[model samples]
Target: MTSPAPAPETVAHDDLCPICHLLLYAPVRTECNHLLCASCMAQWADASTLTRITPSSLDMDLSAFDPNYDPTPDLEAGCPMCRTLTAAVPDRKLAGFLEARYPAAYAERRVEEETARGSRVGEDGVQGMMILIGNRHRAERGGDEGPNKHNWTFFVRVSRPDIVKEIRVNLHPTFRPPRVVLTEPPFEVRCLGWGTFTIEAELVLNEPYGWVKDGMGSRSQSLELSWMLDFEGRGKQGRVRAKVKKLDGDADHPIDVDARASPVNLPHMDHQHV
Candidate 1:
């Protein structure tokens, strides 16, 4: 018989037995998937224990390690993938190997970990009364479709019908010298208006900025008014809302105010109005 195709070379776990080599064991694996005896491995793993490999160093070893206990430490319990006994373990480095080798498993672990912590909700809903504004625009009032040269005045009125005190108005930065006028209690009101004109608050006869912009631009200015209702009560809360009313008849109609842009006639004859 042809010399049996050289019997596949085989390695053993105890090939370099620490007992015979007189060195600490460094566990290694075999081709047949058997663990090797490492001389250095045993020494490092059990360095703190009272285990003596060499008789001459017995005194020091006895003091450090437990003499009665035989420490048999395995680098790893078993193969992570196959769950079978392996000759060697990568130890802490095993995480990287497993993640690269098994992406699906790694992802599953991450998801499981996150789920165990808690669920996340993006935002909270308002339980008490709160006001939100939007859709503000501006343009010359009444005169013509094109840009006007008249100044406009827009009035915003807020009615707080609650036992509230100290209301704050978060006016948009663009509101020229935003002024807060307090009128009445159990209902605080403020008036703010501005525009470009020479006389009293008047609307421009034509679009002022329309020359550079088509149908888009600052057709109206925006103002954001927030109210900080400081009222004391168990269930009493205040609500705020704004309505833009034309203060000057120069504009065809008063611009309904929102948290967006609104058109107001520019002031005219500043010297006389001031």
Candidate 2:
């Protein structure tokens, strides 16, 4: 019998943040192509006294505008290392990649983070909200091009949108600025990749709503979740209906239909303009 192949892993050898001088955790990418831990970047940006338009951390949803919206610019602080604009987004993709290549070390980093953040959420038995994971991949040239070289879009849906104050997506570190926070509806993230990877997120509830009782009658404000991206699954795989015609030369796409076997674009995508 032949043995199965091992999973792919892209490791970063001692990828440390310039500010913290520690392994990048929930890292973010600066415009100058520099990597820094998300918390470190946040602190740096916060320390900035720039009177410019600081981007809001809360991802916005222009519901009426639907699929088109402007992305806020990066913060106006000089990077601690390069003195470039501190503008950065969570480099969850890199985090994902690092986690894959250094599972034990990455796990230790996660534990450190959790510890600094008050350890685990109270195990009140309450799950907080349900997380639905989905994905859609488009071949290079309508399946005639390159199938192995396609983009992978990973996203999530919240069970209780009303109570969800914010949805923070922790993408596989393989993606730049792998962490994303959505303050509006249709919480999701898009990244270009060839294969599937893990996805994680947490739903931060509005104070009182955050506290809840579970079936076993316990209370906690934790709604952390993890899921694998399924390219061959059915889970409403698109934000707005995407057409191959507008995409490439296939014009006769089904009018305004979601879940086509093609690529998709939606508004408010973390670090994604289209």
Candidate 3:
């Protein structure tokens, strides 16, 4: 019997937005089928004026009465490339393709935008830290099978190495009471397991800081993190960061956070059944 031919591969084109000259973000398609970034088109529409007005009379009082006086500027929108009047619509397929093909670029852009917005710090005087979790082994495999298989070693990391004193990682009932501890920077741990768990970290602060009531320290501030290991859109690994804040009554909460994974490394996989 002859073997069936391999399925044809889909190739992505190196298409760049004319305005940004880079991979499109939130791409939109004009009626002419040309693609452009949504933000870029919006900006062009605001800047480009369809009509220009000149007052016939120089007198300020009679300017309003002048026949040639047109107060409003025409802001009709058109394609920046072809100058064709068309309505831009969201191109979901192209958006998905850009995200999947350029995962690193998208992640970097997200980080840059977040940083520009000053989201790395909390208003409550708490600092921000990054938590990187993933399996290097699975990443190295570079195959479809490893991503789908659940048996892999996972790791966790803290970005602010200088402030962290100790890290305690605890897996649910599988690995209990004896929490894994690390006393240094790169507070990362590796283990072979699946599911979610709690992480607690002790911080080396400049002075005693926490919820103090009636001249007594009620609760010490700690960075508590929880994450789950599941192969969904996050292929082999992913990274997340949050701002740690000390709340009233000694409660700690992380906020103003972000998480991202590479679509290239973790492409959507199809399941096979026997």
Candidate 4:
């Protein structure tokens, strides 16, 4: 029998990155056996270099000096806490622990990685996508709520942009296919409706391609997006929460989309009509 997974609260302190004081993301193990976020390590490496050469007095100019010219090259990449030289290597064990113990944090990290990698677009140029549904009302009337207003968008463009014919996006069981063919990256559409649904996207590639036979003409693949949205209160006075499900792709795919709720004030809009 397997042991039960530890609660997030129980593993919070152990899983936190020392540098960020938050849950570890893309954690790496040091030679000193300490774990830190990959991003934190990168930032610390730069800061450590600055600390080594930075003059205490602002009057001094160090611009002419080479930043990479370290007096003690062997002592580079020291741990901020222990001051012990260390190397950053992915801690698979710690990563698994975080995935099991703190799934939300892990998911958030995945989203950030995807965004940093240009929306998870791969070498093949066929990549996963994120669909963002924003509250127009909240966007128009600025509030303490930040810019997004519960919107997150991700999508992949055709590899051979020149040869690509068209793209079709179908919102399962409800809306009709868009009248126009998508020729750009966004592939977005506008509609007024509520309730969660599946988004079926179809990509049509040009003919004479490697994947297609000479007589077979075009080639295509279908990707699906299924997510959830919730409304907490009555019409126009409620909040909206949304999240994206695991994308439909190969096992090794790196894209993971997530979202947070923003206040949805639709006093003028009626759900009865929707």
Candidate 5:
């Protein structure tokens, strides 16, 4: 008999794009820290400018008129809701997170995106998604001693965290236990360091994403990654500009995208990501 279906992935509403109201596909983080799909933002720039709104109850008196009351969103300016008017960068790490957490949904979006953009992936499954390591640090006034005096919390923002059985982080060799194992959502490791160093991690996959070979999947899978830390300052944070690598050498089984997480939306269903 066939095996039971893998457990469905879970994610917060925040992970959903405001425009499409679906898990973000190719997320682009605006300067204002709002995340929306690149495609959706492009459409907004092309047509959905937050132009002046007609106030149903405006005081049309001379005293009510303010000198600086501009409401129209700048053309291709900024986020539609906030109107910050700045550049939006592609968030590769988040995209990877989506793939690992929402395989079916991500695949569907990938196909839809490719079709819309007239692009295509190799016959093989979607490019394997890699484990992306993310972190944030703050200046630590009281540290042992060294130029790298900060307390940084390294974290992985993968969705469907349950699929990850455990996250093993390999720290500097000098530490008593160079390898640290974490078993929980928002897998994070807070550490005090005095020097910038490279960190390696291995994530063991569980049901739904584990132990698959050469394509397709069974339910037990794992991925390994390494990211070098740059304690420059001001939490500028390292970029996800690292070399591209496939996740676990294969994507989740090629499940029909339409089978889950319906991505369809109707006009007037404004579910902005506030």
Candidate 6:
């Protein structure tokens, strides 16, 4: 028979991007404090915004008017959906303005781009864990239905040496998407499935804290999650661990998962992290 897959390599520390599961290229932060792929964040935001807006048909009544509303205020931030902060934007307000403007059909382009990047992963062979996070739906052209909402999902599996544990994982979606940067640290995105449960990760810094300069100083942050799973081995039980990091060029960041529970009989349970 063919050789089995090798065990995951252990590194010094978990330093990869949780979103892209790669190196943090240009990082951005969410309101609840989670990281994302800079470019992916940008597309998600743009798509969300385009899906949220509906053009007036010029045939409505006076009740539709809000005296306190100003069209200028709505355009205040560029792509309100893409809300992460970055260094290239010295004037944060300016970036928001640009995002609001239609950049030659950016939404469609974003979907295509994301699809191309996602086509690189392989298939899964067994039962796994999936986390559906958030999704955005952009409005289709020639329509007044506004933007449709899409949901994002993440999947994880026990590849090598399965074990047992009662641990849980959580992901918070209350924060707005962040802006994409170009010259800062990079992040990673782990592919945990074959069909539709893949997620992109980024290094999002909490508000009032700010981005850290490379080689200067490091910032402490944690990703907010919302789900957990109880894994139990069917045969001889052991230990397993899950970690996050960024993915560089052709190099895959290593993951170590060890679980332990004798006579394993893991009954799956669902719980959200507070």
Using TM-score as the measure, name the better of candidate 1 and candidate 6: 6
Off by over 4 Å in 6: 1-100, 103-105, 118-251, 259-261, 264-274
Which stretches of model 4 miss by more than 4 angstroms? Answer: 1-11, 48-75, 113-274
**What is the TM-score (0 to 1) of candidate 4?**
0.30
lDDT for each residue of candidate 2 in 118-180, tens digit (9 for 90 to 100)? 222212111212334455545333366644444555555544456656666766666655666
Model 3 spans > 4 angstroms off: 1-126, 134-151, 176-178, 193-220, 231-241, 244-274
Q: State which candidate has the highest TM-score.
A: 5
User: What's the lDDT of the predicted structure labeled candidate 2?
Assistant: 0.48
| Global local distance difference test of model 4 | 0.40
Worst 10 residues of 1 by lDDT: 119-128
Candidates in order, TM-scores: namely 0.17, 0.36, 0.30, 0.30, 0.37, 0.20
TM-score-wise, the better of 1 and 4 is 4
Ranking by lDDT: 5, 2, 3, 4, 1, 6
Q: State which candidate, 4 or 6, has the greater lDDT.
A: 4
The ten-residue window of minimal lDDT in model 3 covers 265-274
Residue-level lDDT tens digits of model 3 in 112-133: 4346422223223333333454
Lowest lDDT 10-residue stretch of candidate 5? 265-274
Error of 1 at 91 (Å): 56
Q: List the residue pairs that clash in candidate 4.
A: 129-154, 129-155, 130-154, 236-266
Residue-level lDDT of model 6, residues 181-217, one tens digit each, is: 1112111111111112212222232222211111222
Residue 123 miss distance in model 6 (angstroms): 12
From the highest TM-score down, the ranking of the candidates is 5, 2, 3, 4, 6, 1
- Superposed by TM-score, candidate 3 places the C-alpha of residue 152 at a distance from the truth, in angstroms, of 3.5
